[model samples]
Target: MIDGLKPYAEMKDSELCWLGDIPAHWRVKRAKAVLRRIDVRSSAGAEELLTVSSARGVVPRRTANVTMFQAESYAGHKLCWPGDLVINSLWAWGKGLGVSQHHGIVSTAYGVYRARDASGILPRYLHELVRSSPFHWELQVRSKGVWISRLQLTDESFLNAPLVVPPLDEQAAIVRFLDHADRRIRLAIAAKQKLIKLLEEQKQAIIHRAVTRGLDPDVCLKPSGVAWLGDVPAHWEITRLGRLIKLTTGFPFKSDGFTHVDDDIRLMRGINVSPARLRWDNVVRWPMSERPNFREYELIPGDIVLGMDRPIIQRGIRLAVVKEVDVPSLLLQRVARIRVRGDLNAEFAALLLSGRNFASYLAPIFTGISVPHLSPEQIKAFRLALPRAEEQQKIVEDVTVRTGAIRSAIDRAEREIELLREYRTRLIADVVTGKLDVREAAARLPDEVESAEPARDEFTADEESDPIEVDDEAEIEGVAG
Candidate 1:
């Protein structure tokens, strides 16, 4: 589309297939020609070992799985240096590759390779090339065995693979452009992540303020003397949960009671409870014969349900509100259904259950030898600071408005992230699969290549090295230190 390059569509088959058409002066080579394997063992000592994280790449070796404190000696581990490429042999398929920038050792499980000629082939460009789908497909096809769980790239296979080489200057320019684009995308992602965190924190702050202090801040206040809730509005009453609501446990429903029926009835389980909402995707239906016993467990549109599983409680489970589709839904035995009675507001009660104040109150009360649980009596007897019906509605309305805005922002940001990821994948596919020509694409770059000359020496394998053993104790000590 720009100048100095032609489209791949006009090129003949003899010119190129995988990379479309490139400059006639360009030559294709194998990855092994530019990468040299480095495998050397280190003594078992106190040297810090580095780990490769899928998200962070090569970081300080302290986080490796081996113990670092007790080992008396150090032996055999592969040494890595700055500009060297390290990859977990078992996880290479997942893109567990990193360009190291520090002097350290890696476990024997990782493969370390150095660029044979940095000027001839840019390391960054090669790294990006290997990650492309075309290169990965070649690796997959050359891999042995039906299952590629522990596949490693053989030297022969690596040497035989074809690479699309442009002039050295053009390769460097392409790398620069890609790095800039990648940095921009990463910054955008980080900004979105920070916004999501701020929204979440704001949501929690709103709930905490509303539950602890009534909608009318100018109202007379007093010390409730309760440690969990420091103080309450003077006019508000502190009452036990038993007095304000009805707490009941659901009857035991076995797997035999489940049925695949076209009915309105659904059985609510802990799995149905998700973050801030309910998921009925795999919900099971219950028979009508068992409906009466579950009447007390029947969830209403505004009722709040809590998981009674001790582990779930320990993991900080929050109460969820029910909807119309969940009206006929019956709760399982390990779930507690709380229904507001008299003049109490159901939405307000649900809000209290959803907030930090209620969670802080209930966290300590849950106790057990093996599995912690909350009894019906305990739920009923729990203390709560209650506001008048009018004030409760006001607090609920305020929280709904604030939290609704935050939820909407999170939803939109998540969608944008998805779109960006899709665009990145499509771009890579188009470039790597010959659907687009890199030479023509390079013409759209901000700068043109300074030279069309190729480097002198190509990549070649160095002398083979022996496998190294890593000290388990020193590795642990490094992490603990």
Candidate 2:
């Protein structure tokens, strides 16, 4: 998967628009010419549900990470077999196409296809070729819709698209080679991810110490009478969340009243709340005309917003602090706005809630497995410790500096992972497009490549296992990118 690898011994111009050249013996064909469409729908409306992802191939939705829109029934869902191909119409441009290794059902919106003749092409080989940039580019061109990014890759369009096919044996060799290479790359990525996790933990350690205790190493300490927390500064005060903050629940805004237009006030949903921040990229809006007295729902600087549903992710709470740019936004149901009373410092309160102590308490109270939910009372019941006004500001300022260095390390590690992902994408494009010869490399792989090993980093066994119920909002809250 590098520039030094030799190209095919002999090559010819394939004369295809996306694919310029290929091995002389390889054949250039339309997707439909080499594949037949599969249109079998679930007669019983019951089957193992499946999902398609950018990195991982099609896997059972029940055994995959949380996905969007879990259907109440699969009655109209299309049936797909182990060797078939599935393409997510809306996100095909983002590498949302793959070959399924399971016999299950998928949403009707997806396009399913079976090889017209298996003897002529390998499904695994086609999987890589389809995911390669050339095919992705072709799909984008064939996609038809009003929005450029969200184009639809309909059945007819996807089937008619072009593909480059190598002989069956060579195709097998390519899959084996790429698989070995991918495993190696994924392992490296996993190590980087571990490093990032460590850095984050280091940052959190600083915050936990500063907020729970105090900045002074020799400060007199006393027990707060809480099991999770050991000792706090002798001068600090202990209180319930009800005493230190004013909490307001978001209104239940009607769905039909929602709009994407600019004239409306942005409605902050559970999706907008991420760990310690608000992501504005995919927010829905409330029409200013039909909106109720939503001004009361408007957020202001220093207010902390937390998702009432599935607020805990990987054992940490998700909080978003309102900034000037984030103002004028109204909160929607299952989300709550928090404002600290004059007795508690706002910044100190946010840091405290974002810590592990807050999450541990909520974990036992929220009952749902897939979709966790919390009542307003459960939130107010939290035990909190407060420092004098001046001491609170000192702790916030000191913790900020202490975590800054650790955060820098985490950011650098994250960037490395992104670069590695980009490289892996390019490597696949080069290999599938006949830019590199990996026959020798594929044959030289170690025996462990064939053994069952958990894919790490962005993908993992836990991430790909049975229906994860955290609450309906978890699906919207934890989207990758």
Per-candidate TM-score against the hidden true structure: 0.54, 0.78
Worst 10 residues of 1 by lDDT: 459-468
- Per-residue CA lDDT of candidate 1, range 1-481, in tens? 2123333554333243445554445567765777778887676544566766433356675333222232344456677887777776544554555677677767666778787865376666666666665556666665554334445655555556676655677666556555444554555665675676577668778888887787777877899878888888887888877888877666777755577575647877654653356656446678877688667777788778875543132112436788886667888776778888975788888766766766676667654333345677767766778888888888888888878978899779756765665665556544433344465345455643434322110100000000001110111112222
Give me the runs in candidate 2 sitting further than 4 Å from their true place. 1-3, 8-25, 43-46, 67-76, 147-151, 216-234, 240-309, 320-341, 373-381, 450-452, 458-481
lDDT of each: 0.60, 0.74
In model 1, the runs with Cα more than 4 Å from the true position are 1-27, 44-48, 61-75, 117-119, 139-162, 214-229, 232-398, 428-481
Candidate number achieving the greatest TM-score relative to the actual structure: 2
